[model samples]
Target chain A: MQKMMQQVVCTVDVVLLTLQDSALKVALLKRGRAPFKDVQALPGGYIHPDTDADTRDAALRMLAQKTAIQPPYLEQLATFSGPARDPRGWSISVVYYALVPFDVIGQAGQADVTLASVDKLPRLSFDHRAIVNTAVQRLRGKSQYSSLPCYLAGEAFTLPQLQRIYEALMGEALNKVSFRRKMVEMDMLEAIAGEFSAAGAHRPAQLYRLKPELRDQLTLIARGL
Target chain B: MQKMMQQVVCTVDVVLLTLQDSALKVALLKRGRAPFKDVQALPGGYIHPDTDADTRDAALRMLAQKTAIQPPYLEQLATFSGPARDPRGWSISVVYYALVPFDVIGQAGQADVTLASVDKLPRLSFDHRAIVNTAVQRLRGKSQYSSLPCYLAGEAFTLPQLQRIYEALMGEALNKVSFRRKMVEMDMLEAIAGEFSAAGAHRPAQLYRLKPELRDQLTLIARGL
Candidate 1:
């Protein structure tokens, strides 16, 4: 006698994050079908056989398939499963979050894309608003103790630029002296011995690069740190 | 003309947490059929109309159906969707974490059910182990800033008992004075207005209960504050 076996279905969704015009933006693709036809949503799809690749790889693949942007950083965000979430049938979705440098994503200028502030956004399809809220909250909370904000920046940037990113995401201005002091204490930044003087700025501010070793260490520590 | 539709499968897996033997434990159920037949895994099932009321409801329903544990606290954890994650086809699973008070799950023992720890665990089916790991990490991290740990304790508990739960989840010993100070500062605890004596212990310590109103406020503040 064979035991009764139940078949389950799975899919992947992504919350793509990038900065535009000094505002944090999330990528939302317009769905073209019923249930949520023509509604804006995070880019995602069925996990393909090729999805055997690492989790990030799967997210990147799905993003690329749906949109023209290739994100640099991707992390597992959270999963959403409810019987009626999808009108089709029993479906569970593992949601991943991708953080791309604003410049990289903006270069594409995809017509269907729109950059919106995290606070004010359009109605999303299928509990995506909740997923994005959770991801943003996690990103903000983790950025306080980790170098996550750096992931949103390019390879090299001025301290002030980095500070602005943190301030924007945190929605508060941090005291310059105190913020830099804390960063120095963390030992996650390496002075680049260079300065940025683009766009006729007042003074050339000192630049720093995230230490690769420290970044990796922080990733491990961020789990429990 | 009808729009091209994409069909994908979804599922819901749950990490039901309970306190047993003064340690954190998770509920695992045995699979009755292949892909990892007879192996223990988190209680979950396909999200179907007859089976699951909705995506969020699936986890709770699965828990009740499989383990008969209706946990009070259930939150969506993450979604896992990788093409090859399932042998059958492309699948995505929305994983949920449920914090069941020790007393609520104690009833499961009456039904001859077992809850296991991460250390002494049986073989689990599929990416369920990875799902459990992610849930545990999130629980540990959130417990620090939220009153989640209190949910695992009895209605009333000693400060030391509460602290031990934190240490066990975090796998680290916190400074007693500092920990107590932080808890008091949060104003999330209230002395039971009396003291209780313990057997084979030094001195009787005052018991405290989580202030419900304060805890709800803290949850909000922790998200934005």
Candidate 2:
């Protein structure tokens, strides 16, 4: 007698996010087949067996294949599963959220890289809308108490640039003085030894990079802080 | 010409959690049949076709069926998908983290309510261990800035009881004064205007319940606080 085994299908989805024109934008791909054909959706694909380290790596591979973009920062977002989420059957998707510097993704300039405002994105396919909504909420929430927003900013950035990313993500303005104080108190930022070079801005403000040691500490602090 | 329809199989797993004797315990059920027969695992099953709300609803349904307990609070933890996560074929599990009052679970007292501590849990079957680990990390992370630990407390609880739950989940000790101050600042707790009748070694402390409005606020805060 042979024993029957239960089979399940898994997939990974990527929500590639970038800051463009002071607005947060997400990378979306147009589905090409039935099930939510021709609808705008996040870049995703099946969980390949040999090419990736984990679900996150699978998401990166899918993103690279579909959009020719390799996001610099990726984090696991919540997963979505519903009996009817897929018209097909019981499929579960592990969603990963990625933050790419505007210049990096903007450099790709693929037609699929739509720059819709985070607040006013098009109707996404499947439960993609809910997945994106939760990712945005997590991004905003972590930004309040961690150095995560720094990943969304360029390698080196002015305090205001960092603040703007927070504002864009949170959909609200923050007091510069208070925000700076909070950052300093967290001790996650390091002054880059001098002021910014005279560029296209008001007065050249000081530049800073996130302290490396602080990421793990922030990970722990962000857990319950 | 034939149009192709893509179908995927999905499942829901619940990592039901409660505080027992000042330690974090996860609810696991014994697998009765193959894949991993008779092995301990998180209580879960396939999403029923009829009357299932979503993956989350399906997880709740499974929990109810297995443990005869209904979690008042359930949140999507993450989706687990790997080509080989299941022995049969490609499978994905939509995992959910549930917080139920210890007293409520104790009241149910179902014969199968196997409460295993995070530190010394039995060898869990499948990727259920990984799923539970992920949920535990997420729970500790959320407990820091959210009022999540309060949910583990019974109807009425003392500050010390609440503090102990936080300590157990985070695996760290906190100063009582600072913890109280932080909780008060959040404005999510309302004092019950009385003291605990069952006194322990320490002085009988004041009791508090979560404010109703705070539930909505907590959902927001738990995302990243």
Candidate 3:
């Protein structure tokens, strides 16, 4: 029975996301060859059986090859599979979403990489549109009560900067006092003592970074704002 | 080049969970054949390419055939893969977890089924122990803010009965007043008017059921208690 069955194609797709121009953007790569020749698609590749040990590793490999960046936060989004999902054969794709810092995007992400705002996404190849949508919901839903947004703010960030990033992702203005209270309640950030920068105001704002314990992982808040 | 690659084995495993004797339990079936022959394993089987159109279908088929019960709540848990995960080459198993009511367990589940307490689980076959652990964490984590617990409470239940189920899974004594407050906040259940029953107390306990809109599906609570 094993020898007679058709092999199911396994692949990994990354919904690489970052904040660009104060908007949440997902990186898309141009296909090198057909079936979707020249079409922009999510960064993806076949999992190399010889080289990759796990699906997560395969996702990392694809991201590294395409973007040359090891994102600070990555999580398996979902597995999308069906006979009709692919043109060649029945295939399964374990989709992952990675958060990249905005400043790092210009220095890396090789040619053919294009960051498209999730709100106004171009028609993506394969079942990628559905995949991207699912990843967005996960990000937004988890962001309400998790230390996930920090991945977009980079290593050193101020409370105001962090609050801005959250606002951009959720597309809403938040009350400054209440937001600060929530950050305190989450206990996910630690103030970087003697580290302050005056961006526009005369008085400098205190810089803070994610606590080591919560870094690169999700820590659920007690409740949503 | 594609033909030269090794074929990945695809299978689906179901962590059919139920509440038994006021404790959480998961269904484990004895494997009849090798490589981990006769070992207690989650109900699983190879995904039939011809008959199964999708991974979820394969999971449901495997569960129904083995358990003789069409589970009320089913969700794709995660996809586990690797070379060493199975003795038979490279394989990927799309794991799904199902919730069944306690009363329905005796009517179905057939022979060869062993309901093991999730807290006091025995050593399972293959990478099953890890799979079970991930599933339990998901169930417990999601339980805090979702209507997921209703799947174990049967079709119609009292608020007190529902609170007891939540308390059992959470391993804590919940304050009745606060629990009712949280239940109202969730908006997933509706009181069944004129359907009060005297189970033990002389005062009748009002019957409540999952709102028609939320039956057999997880409804996210506004906040976790």
Candidate 4:
């Protein structure tokens, strides 16, 4: 019993996601050590009880260390565990998924991390493929009624740009009128006063940003888009 | 690093919830060992990687062993971990929440376990109070647009009985028309042929059961009740 009890392995993994070129992408880093060395996977590390405050702090630290990007929106996704998942004995990985704007990834100037489309992901280390799929499913599911897509849309955007973001995540074109109505019902966005999108052949559209209080939180509608 | 890695405590906790007397209640058991012995908390145990297939298996074993009740619906909630949450050492608990009918609890008839109303919970060990609150919030949130409430209603029930269960969880009186419409949109329930509620002051209503295939799955609607 003592031997088995002491064999439990604990770690935290972060699935840092972003939207790039109208497709969802995830940041991956090649493992430096064995058990899948040089293979790309989610940014993760062991929990340092001596210094880390909690699993969230450990996740944030690992993300910054590996990818050089701090996500604007982050939430606990789920935990994946078993004896067979890790080459080492029984293991538990407390997984978290974060959303960052495409520009944020670019600004990080991380040459070590690779941005891969979620749909066409390569063979990833451990059970990372499944983790990425779960995050994608959650993002798509929450996009129906929550202001989660706004994180991928960046700090400020026009109604048309936000609509395209939502449509891309949901995999379907939405009725513009109903989409706008649902957005209003969520009440999590505010017009950026005196700011508008650059004028093209058509007239400029008013810009909007998530409510200051709701930047770190999600606002959900009673119904979906 | 080796010592800290070996010191991580891994465990599984189950939040077994049921609707009793129109109120949500959680099953709790008193600890038998040190570090808060005799204090009531959620049923949990160490993950036995040698025998248990996964954390979910550990959760089910703990629930059955401690409370003698196996829930019909079980879902992973989230992982709670930190250095302070446990006195023994840095710990990781892969928490799962389960839904069972009130009659299921009665059938188990375990005197060692106590069913406490979630609204008026007593002092619990570890971070169990917060765990129960998270499970309750999840139950109430999913009840808005999924067939999750059906598990609390038992194997078969009339529409009105089901609606009452939904109202109990949501803490709101839903419009009859919209509620029924949303149920139909979910398409997860099927009427039990020739089954009806006993005639009382009001006429008997048709009895329905979650579709056989959906017994272990949830059917979701785009919009809420």
Candidate 5:
């Protein structure tokens, strides 16, 4: 069964996400070369053998180089590969999804980048639309059990804001009492001592962040909603 | 930015699993060439451009050729790639995991193949030991919410047998009533008409298979245990 090993091009693509205008948006950059030149695509690049320590490192580097974003929740979503995906030759892409809150988006000041809503997006180059769909599904599914939804609300947020982000992701309004109880059961959040948020024309709300032990860890909640 | 893309050697590795002596075990094949000759490793090979359709197809082909296994559950685990993972040169492995019942393993009659237990494994060549650990964790984690544990039990198995398989994979004893209740909530099982399994010195237990619609799909359970 000896055969010459086929050479395939490898790339890492990042689905950098942020919440803006109460909806999830993906960061896209313009292609500068042939094969769908000038089209908006996910932030991506070829794996650098000399610099990248691993695939995840390559994903992080690509996200930082393209969008100037270092999100708090970066995860390997899945790998997409096939013969006809690229015209040059057989190619494979290791896709990662990164989640960030609105403040990170504002800090980046990506005026030229296309920050399109996940639901309504323009035609993207390559298999990026499919990749985006898969990442969205993974994010929504994991938001129920893990400490994933908190990443979308930023570091210090009120319960009401976190609830709104969860509702936006799950596409359903949950009862306020039931939602609060569920959050309590998850035990992923902790009050920031006596810190509070300034809400104009509304009562100041207590600020909470993820438990210190769970900031970068993924733990399953016993009772998922 | 003008540098040429790195040329990385790509391959597919599979963690093929089946039950042996009431524990989860992975199939390993002996390597015939240098760079770790005669070392028992995961069933894997270089991607073939003229033959393999994609990473998954290459993994399937490797498992079939090495162990004679066509698993009921097969999925892409993760891409384990970097320089120094392989001794030959710059290499990347697209790792996948496959699950089959005991009957398939018995049918293969692999005298030279080694079925290593997931809990206690000998030193494996390359990064296969780490890959096996990752696959085992993923299987155990997903078994709580998906129709994954059923794949460990053969088709049309009794409830007790299925529960035993679940306990083996999860490494815990589950309450019988609670487990049954969770299975009922899943609604992914169907009783085989007029069929029963012969239990020694006891009444024949009813045989059930996954529902027709869920035989090939991974459906989420309402409550994960």
Candidate 6:
């Protein structure tokens, strides 16, 4: 019965992603406790079953306590579990990934949290490397036909600016006319009143922001950009 | 310390979906033990940390033991957890959704299992009703731009047969020319040697099967059907 009753360790981890200098980056912090202590890893903590309402809440709490950043968009990524994953015992981690603008992460000024280029990440704690990969894959895959890249482009941006962000995530240049057409199909953006990008002396492109209702959700298009 | 040491109940549930009579259906079983004994619910069981290699293994085990059906395509849907979801205590159920041909499920011949149309499901135990909705939504959403619906069409089928399966999941009629174009873009199917669907008066349609490598993974198209 003791073996049958053996408890599985439950925790929540966050893969906070941002776009910086045209490259995708993930937030990492030095583990303050044993079991990979002092090693850089995704922000994580044990789930407080008594106090936490759910895993999402636990994930938000861990982010606030560890990095002092509350992302505007957060979604559950996937759960990673196994007997050999953790040194302590059988364990499970309900992972969530958050998207934030580059400036927002910089504004948070998390001294302990460092941003690492996803393309050149160092050795991460536990299975965090794989977790980060999964999150990045999800972001890129969804970027094909959804407004997911908008979160990385900040609250307001010009069409050209948004296309650059999409190109960065998708790793390819998209046809401009078709890209705009797909954006129209998505219908998740609106012109920011009286706002335009200062594009030298030629033309000032109108700035746009995600519709209020779509800020927390993705607007998907049928044909990808 | 004891309160902090409290164990969260870990379980795995599967949402097995198939198409029966042109309607999307889900598999369910009657619970054999308390707390909700005799209740019809998604097949689920506790995680055997000592034996199961991972949560996916646990999910597969539950499906095999309860329904006697092994699916050709099974993917982790998401993890559902909270204190109130289960009366036992704080619990985590890693949910997986499987897609199989209707006849495969029928051939299993499990006496205790039953199929219910997704659109008209009866009251399910726990948060199962919500879980069912999520699975159905996932199926419908992916059906627009993926080979996911092919799993419900069986190993070998004609283009017309596949299109009908896609229509059933998508809940809309697709233009034939565009649908075939999208299929060509997906590039996950191949003509089966010397196989064709019989037609009473016209030419037989060539039978196709998913490419060997694409069977276990989804083939996603940029533009949807």
For candidate 4 chain B, the 10 contiguous residues with the lowest summed lDDT are B1-10
> Docking category for candidate 5?
medium
Ranked by lDDT, the better of candidates 2 and 3 is 3
Q: With candidate 1 superimposed using the best TM-score fit, by how many Å does residue A66's alpha carbon deviate from the native?
A: 4.1
True contacts kept of each: 0.38, 0.37, 0.34, 0.66, 0.53, 0.54
Candidate 1 lDDT by residue in tens digits, B137-222: 88887776667777777678898998888777777888999778777766778898866747365888888987867442334213
Task: Give one digit per residue, the lDDT tens place, for model 6 in B1-225.
Answer: 334435577889999999998999999898878878888899988888888888999988988998888889999999998899999888888999999899998889998889999999987888999999999998899888888999998989999899999988988898888888889888999999999988889799899999999989999876677
Q: Which stretches of candidate 2 lie above 4 Å from their native place?
A: A1-11, A33-38, A45-54, A83-91, A171-196, A200-225, B1-9, B172-178, B190-207, B212-225
Give candidate 5's TM-score. Answer: 0.95
lDDT of 3 by residue, A94-155 (tens): 88999989878778947678889898989778999999999999998888888888899988
Cα displacement (Å) at residue B43, model 2: 1.3
DockQ of each: 0.30, 0.33, 0.53, 0.71, 0.52, 0.60
Candidate 3 C-alpha lDDT tens digits along B1-225: 464234577788999999987888999988899878888999998877667888889888998899887888899898898888998767788899999898888888397788998888887887998998899999888888888988999878888889899988777888999888888888888888889877875677889888887765677878686
True-structure lDDT of candidate 5: 0.84
The alpha-carbon root-mean-square deviation between model 2 and the true structure, to one decimal in Å, is: 4.4
**For every model in order, what is the iRMS?**
7.9, 6.9, 2.0, 1.4, 3.2, 1.9
Colliding pairs, model 3: none
What stretches of model 6 exceed 4 Å from their correct place? A1-5, A198-202, B1-5, B200-203
Q: Write the per-residue lDDT of candidate 4 for residues A123-196, one digit (tens) a residue.
A: 89888999999999999999888899999988899999999999989999999998899889888999999999
List clashing residue pairs in candidate 4: none
Clashing pairs in 5: none
What's the CA error at residue A121 for candidate 6, in Å?
0.5
Candidate 5 true-interface contact recovery: 0.53
lDDT by residue (B38-148, candidate 4, tens digit) is 999999978998888889999999988888888889999998888888898878889999999999988999988899999999889999999999999999999988899
lDDT of 5 by residue, B111-212 (tens): 777888888897788899999999999998998777788987887898888888888887899899988888888889999999998888999999999988
